[model samples]
Target: MASTIRVGVVGCGFYAQNHLNSWHELRREGADLTAVCDVDPAKAEAAGGNFGVPHYTDAAKMLDAEKLDVVDIVTRHETHRPLAELAIGKGVAAIVQKPFATTWDDCVAIVDAADKAGIWLAVHENFRFQTPMRHVKRVIDSGAIGRPTWARINFRTGYDIYKTQPYFYNEERLAIADVGIHVIDLARFFLGEVAHISCETQRRNPKVRAEETATMMLRHESDAVSVVECTYGARKLPDPFPETLLEIEGETGAIVVGIGLRMSVTSNGQVSEESIGSPLRSWTSEPWHASQEGAFNACQHFLDCLKRGVPADTSGEDNLKTFALVDAAYKAAEEKRAVEPENWRRKA
Candidate 1:
């Protein structure tokens, strides 16, 4: 209670509502929902009214007004850089939404700013924080799957995502930037850092402006290989929308995460299988609950770290590695060859 971290959330839009809800749910764990901000007065007023927190149309004003310890940047990718800079500039810790920024350079700039300011900055990359994925990680750590040599992480669905966020149809970097980034992050989470990547992209949906399907091959630094794929073009019965199916093979055994959140592990020739589905919370719903819960879990982790004055698991510096993979994937697709992800820290 005494260690409660006063918090402010910016951008009360479609996806941001999840962050706001999550912060409220985290109050018991010492996250004080101090304020909320958005450019749209109606949206800000609506969220403020519902949450019983003061809302403002200006982020700077809210930051100046509230004695906040942390600020969650839930705005669009383009706004992430400046808003994060604003938070760090004020010496307040910041938690930014994923895709970190619109470009690799911007991502670097934000990380550098946080470093220079000596403030906590973390990216909200929550796919690996999903309940199933956490279970998978625990299995791997327990040595049931030894030295993971190969993995296949898949996210395919035809759910009407655009219906909820129509702006997706016009995004220049559609699928990979939107969802493939999550799958790619999962690849790193399951295996290790990528050594190089080869990818193929498709514009299966005639209506979308950019690629909606991305199939990738990753060579990890450990010489392990993985197939990472995501698409919004699949037309399957009982679509597992928002679920990521996985198959990981190691020296000792294998782990398979299939439809309906079912997971099976083979160790020492013994097979064990069960449902690893995410549970629904009062503020969560079907299909989307897994993702929403992940957001909450990620927020909780960040808050815990902030209170302890430590770097987050998805700290700004660490996420650059994941962002690099996304950048390299697009290049690999264009050239039809493998490309090593860019590392900004290499000595010149």
Candidate 2:
């Protein structure tokens, strides 16, 4: 109920830097970034200095002492559930990064906790908020792509993630669990809930313990089928082979988004393409901070929802479907059979 929301950010890892930058942007606009936390004191201190805020090595200490209105978690995929539960338990709203949790049970627990506590809990699935993608969604909703029957989402980036974050090579955190999850979420964003899925994954780079590439086929309840491809091992090419592309086909027309960092739509025999500037490109690069602009936009939305007492666009409940699809795709690939999205269960 304060004039400005107070925020605390946890985890000072690679992506957390972007969160800090985002929070700083909010601070300039009257929000208060009271504190920051990370397991590594040095990282936390560094982020705090960068954002001109207090630093803590313990998230609980920060949450208890700072009177935070919202807690942003940009930690590893596995840590989301616990961090989110802690935030909700403290009566603070939460915004978490993608791959919500490693398991469905953990995700459900987070959702349940937030619901029981009556606090806003959002998954920072920023790709859905990208300008080009938002435009694509508008076009789809406008019936420009009438009743989309098929689509393909590709994240064939040549970005050398391993070189930047060697931990990504760990088998437990493969490209499928990291990068592919984004495309899976994107597919669900454009289409609807997937009823069934079939997937195939491979580790093209033997050096990495996790799969470097994966392909998945999804069947939506609407009978729409689409292919999604993900790769961390995509070779760098002069023509930007490393890109995110989405091609959607409907009853009347088709649309493609992120075509050369922009959006293009064709409806009723008319075609139009325009460049929607990259949200990430506006940020000044500090090590481990790439897309502060995008992160800021996402964080702002979360804060705005908390202030307005409105449901988040990417709430934890909505993210369960995306998490379910990721789990189903892995299972389908492992078992060499189709996996029903609704049937995905977390391991005990």
Candidate 3:
């Protein structure tokens, strides 16, 4: 293995440029950005010039031609599985964007492929890496909140997504896949594996086919219950509704994250509150772009694992649980009943 990891990024769409910028920064720090790939020649060429990397129209050819140690996938949600599988098969480590795949089976297949190939795999579930969320995790883990029994993760923004990406109107790529997955994963980070879920989904925007709002109840394996709410319908508030609000109530105390980044705790008959700053803004103002920074961190972590021999923070297998929660949430909404997490499965 070389001292500097050779990395390549696939996809140059709306969000791909952030990944390119992060990779260039990482390269300056220590890594090597060997090349970039995109189906659109224009995108590939633009990204290549912006990052000063070799360009290719085909990711497979880029992988075959460059001695890459890591392959970053920032393509469409649908392409994540195949691209990740290809990278694993080619003996390269992989860092994939959120909504790992459309279904549980694809997620399972990606995990299995990485496991069999003995390559590191990580999903870029960045919200949890945000400063406020990270502080919340620290408080919970430190037992300041005691043994958490209930929690809530709320993300609501009025920013018209369709105006930025009209494809968001596509029913096949609903709000659940686009934003709900991140909220689901954030809940899981604090509450652990979800055992059951009940959800209500609605398309508030008449012009769009996909759901604009979703509310889900999740029962975690730790016997903790959580409510997850996501909506593009949220009106911008005086105190802007947090892009995320996580409240965890444990046996000893309770902590609220992303609301002024505060954490409250009660222990031994004593109650206290602590102020913390936001961690989600290290990269960009756009939440999605900020998310890309988390993705870059995930990539660096994957590289570190490859170098030192360890497991990734968001391993492919672990992410299956996150996807399962998403699957259950959608099923619960469709059937108008509570759905068991384990009962969620990919269509054949």
Q: Compared with the true structure, what per-residue lDDT tens digits does model 3 show for residues 1-348?
A: 446878899998887776777666676556788899999999999989988889999999999999998898988778999999999989999988888887777888898899888888888777776656777787788887678899888887787667767888775747677889889988888888778899999888877787889999988879999999898877766333334766778887777665555666666567777776544434555445445655566556666666666777777777777888788888899999999877333321
Please give the lDDT score for candidate 1: 0.93
- Name the weakest run of 10 consecutive residues (lDDT summed) in model 1: 339-348
Q: How high is each candidate's TM-score?
A: 0.98, 0.92, 0.90
Per-candidate count of clashing residue pairs (backbone under 3 Å): 0, 0, 3
Q: Give Cα distance to truth, residue 137, candidate 1, Å.
A: 0.3
What residue runs in model 1 are displaced by over 4 Å at the alpha carbon? 344-348
lDDT of 3 at 181: 87
* TM-score pick, better of 2 and 3: 2
Question: Candidate 1 on 1-348: residue-level lDDT in tens?
Answer: 248999999999999988999999999999999999999999999999989999999999999999999999999899999999999999999999988999999999999999998998999999999999999999999999799999999999999999998998899998899899999999999898888999999999999999999999999999999999899999997899989999999999999999999999999899999999998888999879999999989999998998888899999988998999999999999999999985744422
lDDT of 1 at 336: 90
- Ordering by lDDT: 1, 2, 3
Q: Which pairs of residues collide in candidate 1?
A: none
Error of 1 at 122 (Å): 0.3
